[model samples]
Target: MAKAPGFVSLKEILTTFKISRRTAFNWLKTINQQLQAQKLDQVVNIPRYGYKLTDRTKKSLTQKIAKVSSPQMGHETILNAHERQTEIILLLLDQEHYLSINQLAKMFHCSRNTIIKDFKALKRHFPALKIGSSRLGHRIISDENSIRLTVYELLLRQDKLVYAFINRLNYSFSQAKELVIKAQQQLHMSFSENSLQQLTYLLLFTKWRITHNQTIDRSENWQWIAQNTKDVLPTCTKLLGKLGGNKELKGEIVFLSKIFLCSQATEVDCINKNLYHDINNIAQEIIFRYEQLTEQQISYRVFTKTLCNHLYATFFRVKFGIPFSSSEVDEIKWQYPVLIKFTAIACAPLEHYLQKKLPSEEVALICLYFGSVNNREYREFTESDKLKRALLAEVLVVCSSGIGTSAMLYHELSKTYPLIKFSLPLEIRDLAKIFQHNYQAKLIISTTILPKGKYPIPAVKVKAVLTKHDQTIIDSFLRQEVPRKLEHNASAVNSLVSIINEYADVKDEKGLRLSLDKFIFPGLQKNNKADLPTLSNLLPAKHIKVLRKKDQLKWQTVLKWGCNLLEQDEIIDQFYFEKIVQLINRYGPYMLIANNIFLAHAAPSNSNKKVGLSLILLDQPLEICSRGESAWVTCMFVLSPGKEKEHEKALEQLVDIVRNQENINRLLKAKSPQEVRQFLLSFY
Candidate 1:
């Protein structure tokens, strides 16, 4: 029997392509499909991995080549040497070039004698050139472009590995086919289109990296240093023990190690240095903000909240050590809305620009707006005609639930009935003398049911019946619209101290026994204040320390006021300056100076000063201010030299005080600067 037409073995193909068994199998399958699609009936099989070219594949491939040469096909090929050599010689002459017989022999892989015979046949066809040999080299002296196209056409008939290269690089196969068509069109080259397809596919895979981002004819380096660096850094950090040993670490290390395979060591190091610098900058800023808020008794519990997206963005390059991608940037861009919203209610104020720039949807902005308005509920009061008449004689209402609740009531009444500022509680017995002592205050309210003649400050009972004829009751203090301030009514300072003392005197081992009893113990009270830091039940120790430091500073400042011999104005001025400095240091010099000195502010564009700043100021040196409206602010907070965060907070507070009409009025009324500073300071 005649041997079947032979073909290359799968093993040989795999070795030639340097591909794994599986990959080789896949390639063979693809080749077979291409063959069968064209209806060539030829079979080949490796009998392994269910992957082989079947009978139909080889016939299809061979027929595909034959179709190009078939007379019925649109294009024709000159297969005989004599006929092809005439065309080759004429094609070269058309471009003003001549190919020596020797050159033709080397190009076609034939003997010089065979090439000479081909040239003689070509001369008979074109009658143009002499067959000759030269020592320098059998050079091509004809049209380079035409000759090149001729050679290209001849090779195109053989196979299509070139076209396959283009497809593998992710270009559309149609696009790859178009490129081959253009090469053939421009050069009068013709080929079995199947051959070009095969060539482009191989080229696509091998050259994928280099050609990925390029769409034009330009070439680019497939290997990028930054890309390599990103792949390697995580492993380096993990190996150095900087990153933890969990799954996350393992994955990052693997990723980075792969990058090293693609990149040089120098590139990796450069990327690492940049990441370290950025991370350190962020960490240091966070630490400084933590310290500032701690000093202010603000909560820091929100600092640990980060979305999955933010974590990825921040650590991707710094920890994972990867080149940045647009996808990552986009994720972070959308994440800002959520991040800013959550941060609004956090204990520490966010960076000032965020507070100013973010809309009400942002948590910090919402929190600040809400914080500006008092929300405490208050009791409604009504007066009888008799009480109104007595009020003309100056009566006071007092509640002995301690000054806390009553003080709130006093403020409510005082705003509408400004005449009765001295409404002391019924506890003070010297009513007439107390009423006479204050020019601004006249009436008082008493919490306990007491007779009018018995108490100090011209007391009125809490339950005093109301009368319709008393217009002042309806028109003045009883008006419901005025809001009350926050009041702390739990345990009085004296009561708490006395209870603690009694417990200590009794040597109570059960802990705070008398204090708990007298105070009507709240839910889950700890025995020792010292235990506060250890209690995970409470907020972190960081929070408690912050609260303590703030309280300590306030009390210390008050104590200093009582002991100091300086003029009141001098004392207040010193305190105010201290506060100002603190704000500037905390927020940054530009923000502090702008907020405090320049008084720059802006409200919502849609509303008439509904919220936001009402004033703006420009920078000015102290020399100009020394002469002043000749008036220097008495209550200010100043940071120590070189302390930015403290200065920022101080500046913020100073601006807040000056902008607030009520606070400013209170400060101006002070008998001394110290009292002014103390009063202003207490408001925050």
Candidate 2:
């Protein structure tokens, strides 16, 4: 009948069509689109009802369906190449026996060559399919579980086929579905609509396999997955009972359960023992590495919950060698080059712990997991964090290079805004190590480019030394975006209250809590490093020696002269000098890090006693020969790192001073060792 216009709920539509919720919605959308194309009135979905078809639309569609049925359904239905390829794969998955190319060609009403082309396309797209043929027929050559995973992938990519796929079940579809629904709801286990449909169909296929005597061997293979599903076992058992499955069929059920486990979650809280104990730690380590690598902060919630959810499935997929539902690693690698590299580095923890490289597809999926986090807005604090910063705002100050740049920023910022709290100078590498708990800092003021990623707090970019314009920008940020210095005013209020109490007594017993809250907040918010080796500490007048324009020295003598100063100063052992000499001898001009200057050094060792730098400047450059090549050295400096990254700031400063022509000229033209040291000390 062409039914009369009326409101109908989505539930009634699902019941009427015997399709999953996702399929029913998709069908409705397709129907509406077709109606719109024909310039006819379409069905309208009502909120409480499913859809309303007025008399005219109902009558129009009835005529349209009749006209389409005669040609499309009554005769051979032609399919596009992509559509036919999908149906062929579906047939291979459904068949218990191998299907011949001739049989598939006849069923789809296509030639053998066309069918073969489709097969070639399938192999080209999915190498994991392992398409094969024998004299008997062609078939999927992999295990049954793998075939099922491919079906899910197909359904995900081509969702319009979902309705037909779920509709063609051979077993007790309605009753088993009822039981599955009851158990899922009763056990508080829920899944995304798409995943629920896929897993339900997977359960049907598993049951079908068992009925055909293709049951999985060694059920203990699934016992490890049992730990996360103990509470859901009773529900699974009831469904297994409905399928006439005994204890032996338990492995298939557990495997089916994993489909829902790995899929996107909706309302169900995904935290579990493995999550709380194992995965969260992995997520934290991943976050640490991302921070260290990106020099930025991310949403902790995104990392701990969203990313934790992803890692849970990823670990199992890689361990079991299942690469279904992965983005193409190559495609993602090209699209997200920087992100992929950072993800690869961030996942080093997992790779080390797993004692193997992550599969390329898994790496891409994990890249996607990190890719989701790149755009998520940083954490926004409530009044509680603002209250913590109300007293003295914690600001992170960082600079581009040298130990003094950040220090210079801190002194200027603190002097200008004395009421605000500030951290010691920070390097670009140190930004991640700060604000492990983000609420501790309210603002970031940097002399360098702070990472452009999701840094939780507001960051202000300025010069190493503050300008009036920079001060104005900081003033605007503190006023507009940050907490005010309101906590300091609380003490003034207490003093005024005390003076008022000295004059008179007041009574407002019922409003005392509110009264005190006006003066005080309920609670205060509760929230490393070796010193940088500076130039003044590392280089002294005694360590700095120079040569005049008339007194040019050989490059070999230049390296030896500077290195012996370090040895006599007790900065390095004799072998340290030999190591430098050996480096220059073995690798000619290897010590020349800059144009016309040489930085002589050996790897840090136990022999190096202190972190220091010794310099020798020459007015006239000397040329040296080794390995039949020649290079010039106007200045020679020897540095013993003593420890790695400990003297980076001093090294940066030294590079800065040598890079400038005027500074080098002043040192080269120096009258004494005292003058050369004084010129270098000015930079500190």
Instruction: Give the least accurate 10-residue stretch of model 2, judged by summed lDDT.
Output: 65-74
Which candidate leads in lDDT? 2
lDDT of 2 by residue, 1-684 (tens): 135346767776555533345545555665677678878677766565557766777766644321211111224333456666777776776676888888875565445666777788888866667777998888878765656666666654434454465556556666666666776676565544444555566667667667767664434535565565444555666677777777556666665555555554423343356544676677777775565334356646634665665666566566555555522335555555555555665675576566666775566556655554432221233434434442244776665422222333554455455556766555455556455544467778875455676677778887554666777888878876544653354574566666767786757533543465443532231111236777877888888887775565666677778878989978888778778667667756644534576777776777688788888877777887776656777778888875544655576567667656777676677778888878888886
* Model 2: colliding residue pairs: 8-49, 8-50, 9-49, 9-50
Report the lDDT tens digits of candidate 1 across residue range 613-648. 111111222211221221122222222211212223
**Residue 520, model 2: Cα distance from true site in angstroms:** 40
Off by over 4 Å in 1: 1-229, 232-271, 293-684
Q: lDDT of each prediction vs. the true structure?
A: 0.33, 0.61
